[model samples]
Target: MHTERSAAAADRHVGDVDLTHWRSRAGRRIAGAWAALGKRYGAMPLLLLTLAVGVGIAVLATWIASEVYDAVREADDVAVLDRPVLDWALTLRSPTGDRLVTWWTDIAGTIGMPIVALGFLVGFTVQRRAWTPLVLLVAASGGSLLMTIAGKDLIGRARPPLSDAVPPYESSPSFPSGHTLNATVIVGTIVYLLLLRQSRVVTRVWTIVVGTLFVLSVGASRVFLGHHWLTDVLAAWALGLAWLALVITAHRLYLTALHRGAEPEPGALGRS
Candidate 1:
């Protein structure tokens, strides 16, 4: 009877161990599910955070422009250099420089922005049957245009004097350089969408670097050709970066939410 009791106790102990093991496994599974959900929905918070940061930088640019526009309330001695820089640019003019500047400037304007975006937009949509390219183009074009117009009007900071400006003078408020802003958005969007279809890390990196250089060169051309002040270009750069970041981040969050695990490589968006 004692031996029988021992055997029964041992069996009960084994049953308890099994029960504990299953309970632990169930607990771990519940924890893992909660973690996965948190990871998936986490982008919502990230989106809000990015939105705040981007908008904050844009508003900050406006504020800085306001301070600079107020002559008596000048924020720094930097404003003292505006005309000097313009004079230097005017002095640096040459046939070669003029040609280069004109070429670079147009690249961000009628020739480059619209053509590249539209060409890729059609290609991507036809090949992939996805509207992402179109969406990106619209966002970049519409958003940059609206922001440029609104910021210019609100700031009302006059462009450099007509005498100081290059030919085909643009008579618009110049708190933020429209060329710089538009170039950033258009070139940036193209690079981003193209990168989505690419796979080679080196190719991706090189594309980004080249695109960035183009954008920066465009901004410099504006300042060099006396179309805008250094501050105007600076403000445009900051604001444009903010807008681009917002767009890219929002798109990424959208993709993450869609549960598409593997992202397509950057290419022409053709059928794989």
Candidate 2:
């Protein structure tokens, strides 16, 4: 009886070892198959997903901007606040404050903002020895410019009267403030790109906070300087966010395609 029991126990131990070894092999094979499947069929799905997200953002932003336009055109309830906001902004103005705000707001003007964006692009491109950064910057800033032009021309909303505004007046259509929109897109994009390389928590936090403050300050400066109505800045913020979403979505798809072993596009981010 002892001899028979010893043989059975030995057989059971061997069987247990075999089972564990089989399980380990099966797990590795499953993981390999999954990775292979992703490499084979992931690009198209990623492209489709990004397209859906971009379209959704564009549609929502357009709808919101249209609603604001209609309100302004019809002098609806929201439009009524425009005058009061401008009046209040005007009340806050003084010689020193005007100079400071004007100086700050100019940093986001057509010439100034482009210079700022170009500097960032050049610096990043040189540091990484890559053109992806430049490509992304161009796509973001170019789209923003086109959107600003279309919005301003479409709405043809005039700026607040010069009498109510500070000196160095603008004559452009003011439904969407170009300065605010451009600043938001450029600064926000820079922050997004910066965060990709940053691992430290403190650095990431400061990047986000500073970027947010810059965008908000640019928008507020537009109102305080009398270059745009309150609604103009609001609409610009909405539109800028939408464009930024589209840009980031495209970048993500690019990265996903590269990960799946798809042929890389020219100037795609190698480090990403």
Q: Spell out the clash pairs found in candidate 1.
A: 196-265, 196-266, 197-265, 197-266, 197-267, 198-265, 198-266, 198-267
Residue range 150-193, candidate 1, lDDT tens digits: 67877787888887777878888887898899888878888877
State which candidate has the highest lDDT.
2
RMSD for all candidates, in order, please: 16.0, 14.8
When summed lDDT is taken over every stretch of 10 residues in candidate 1, the lowest stretch is 1-10
The weakest ten consecutive residues by lDDT in model 2 span 1-10
Per-residue CA lDDT of candidate 2, range 76-157, in tens? 7655778899989988999999999999999999788999998999887665555556756887887777778777777788
Model 1, runs deviating above 4 Å: 1-73, 110-112, 260-272
Reference-based TM-score of each model: 0.70, 0.76
The lDDT per prediction is: 0.65, 0.71
